[model samples]
Target: MIDQYYNHSTVYQRRTQDFAKSRRISPASTRLYTGASMEPYDEELFREHDVKRGLRNADGSGVVAGLTRISDVHGYRKEDGKFIPDEGKLTICGYDIADLIDNAHAEDRFGYEELAYLLLTGALPRYDELESIGARIGGLRLLEDEYISEFPITTKSKSIMNVLQRAVLLLYAFDETPDDTSAPHEIDVALSLLARLPRIAAIAHITHEAETSGVRVVVPAPNASSSMAEAILEVLRGGPDFTHEEAMLLDVMLMLHAEHGGGNNSTFACRVLSSSATDAYSAYAAAIGSLKGPRHGGANSQVTRMHADIREHVEHWDDDDEVAAYLAKILRREAFDGSGLIYGMGHAIYTLSDPRAQICKRYARSLAQTKGKGEEFALIERIERLAPEVMRDVRGTTKPICANIDLYTGFIYNILGVPETLYTPLFAVARMAGWAAHRMEELYGAHRIIRPAYNSVMDDVTYVPIADRH
Candidate 1:
């Protein structure tokens, strides 16, 4: 009994010390740490060193890094050695995205599964093949009870994406062969995650609401026969509280967001991690972390917040001059987070247009009209039209600019009753297909590690003794 008491005392003492050490850092120490870690580089140094900042060329094109058979993003053309803006085109595997959407809608079938299959395998599936694929993914939609009971929704994170990242990492512990990078195992893991992530995101959103509002939400068990889009809505709404049109619209959205070429930030992050021979879960978790950045998948939420601010401050949504004035203020760093960026207004590659945004714009208008939110949709449309002009006038640049997919997706989600918190999480759900595809490519196609060289700009200095440093 004495020995047991002594051991317990020692463990408790260690835990107490750890708890005390984990306390928030003092403000003074934080300032000192930030100052010591600060490293600022001059813009001119990039040009002098012939460096491609952010791996982007001077004309804003991504540096040709690797090849891809998954999808192609075409936004510009070169003519006579001059940069030329062109209508954006997104092709998945070998099929055009617009044609895929059109065919799926015409047939009145969910297309996200088909798109996912095409991304994973570089070919469109026949009817029977598509049925098999859907059945497999739908069957995997229901997560393991242990996972639901122990992870994600019960955790303390307010950010759904953070929960999602943890949920994915947690899966690594459950898999019997988590490190298997063979084709069959990798594909199975990818499909399982593609099915399970939407459910996790829905539960994470509910968990966040419970924490904030103290109202517990019960997520319904997923239907194995339901499509991915339908399953997400059912879980989030706690039942089948959505329409056929709503489900179809969301399915189209999933297809459009499923892949955006290999160079996209999240997919590239997945590729980079996969190139290092990590497990599928780690690579996917890294992709989720990258997507959570405000400049990437999180841009949809930023766009929503910016629109909300415009709705609150602007007097009239219909008046072009009034909207233009507010947008000019945004571009001039005088309003809306003061970052000098009209969020969702431009794309890195798409200058003339974004094909995904074009489709969403059409569907968003129809849905907004039905939901009696025509005025709000009109305001968003107006912003899309006027933001480029305002930017040109404010910044004095002649660059062609157009709205990206982020602009209309938030409006669509709102009409569907999705919360702002789920905006980026939903992006992760859709882009899981892309990230998995890229991971496969990096593992199988690219045999070498991705190691980019960085040019050091800091001057070498002699080390001083600890007593003489100050």
Candidate 2:
């Protein structure tokens, strides 16, 4: 065990390069951060062995515990972007994401409501069951006046995620059964947050927008008949009207973002917190804080800014050579901040393409065509077409750097008139459903605290007197 070697007599190597070579690991690829850089990010690239084992079972025996897979939560799985195992389809809770999307597009109901049900329960629902769940969640959306009055609307101080986090923490004031962890109580909390956070998020969006634009803003009465998407849109519009097709598209997007299995940072945070027997609000709030990080949820806004920069630099929107050259320059530090990083082009998961990204790209393309604004969309397409090979050549990253869901989401938000600030907040709004589900699963099944131990690298540490310290 690496922990066993931590002592004064343990022959510690001074340099990471020498240590890597001695351990037969790649000096360039081997990464071990001291102090605070290591933030629970266990990547497959960092695995010491080919196969994974439990912490006590693994002894840094080259097992490469690079975090290939962990957690028992089931999501749509595919091999090489094809679901060859189960008749070439992706299934989450026995419901194919593709089929769910297709069925939602075909159905009159808001697909997201059904998706939330599927995630909360382990099975897909019949029409009546789905409708019943929808009405149940809808009725749970009401908030007391004092609760509504205390909510934060505009903030240059706190982050959107923090606002959501504090909002959940504040729910403790209204919560009479804070000590309750029963399934029925948890489900009630989950459904209430699912229905209510959106309204609060929508108000936050309008307040922020109006604050920025110097316009006095007020939220109108919510429509009881409106679907989730329609309700969120109505709050934004300050009325009870929105186009049906647009709401459908928004519903699909929200469904797609609802859950990505339990391994994701935010969802994992929810499970871990729930394992500590914390209330659902605390667990869900931890997830919001996790999603607030740029590496996780904020990538969407970064992509938006990246697109703006690319448009300013590229002289010809259609030229392949121009796009390639600009991309190369950006990667090579000859242009654009010299960071040598490409945002929204790579996903840590999925070797070929993220299926959700493909769906989102199609929606973005159709929207562009309908609106007759293809320049930026065309530019995005060009980057997507060329980025895989270009990024591979630029940085020797082991994984395929293809388009991910973040690629088009920011643009889609812009198309829907959502402020850039609300991108991550809205992500939290949608992901709350998944967080609640995970929290419930963790609390109900695990019945243990998720406390993990850390190993220290330093072996020799002697206390010094104040004079020696000086």
Q: Highest TM-score: which candidate?
A: 1
> Which candidate number would show the highest lDDT if scored against the true structure?
1
lDDT for model 1: 0.88
**TM-scores of the models, in the given order?**
0.92, 0.81
RMSD of 1: 10.1
Cα lDDT tens digits for candidate 2, 178-204: 668899989888888888888877776
Model 2 lDDT-worst window of ten? 60-69
lDDT of 1 by residue, 1-470 (tens): 32454445455455445544576656446444334234334456688899998899998889988988988999999888788999999988878999999998999999999888888888889999999988898899877878777876455587889889999999998899999999999999998998899998898888778777999778788888899999999988889998998899999888888999888899899999999999999999999999999999999999999999999999999999999999988887899898888998888899899999999999998988788998999999999999888888888868799999999999999888889999898899999999988999989998989999998777789999989965
Q: Which stretches of candidate 2 lie over 4 Å from their true place?
A: 1-90, 153-158
Model 2, residue 68: what's the lDDT? 16
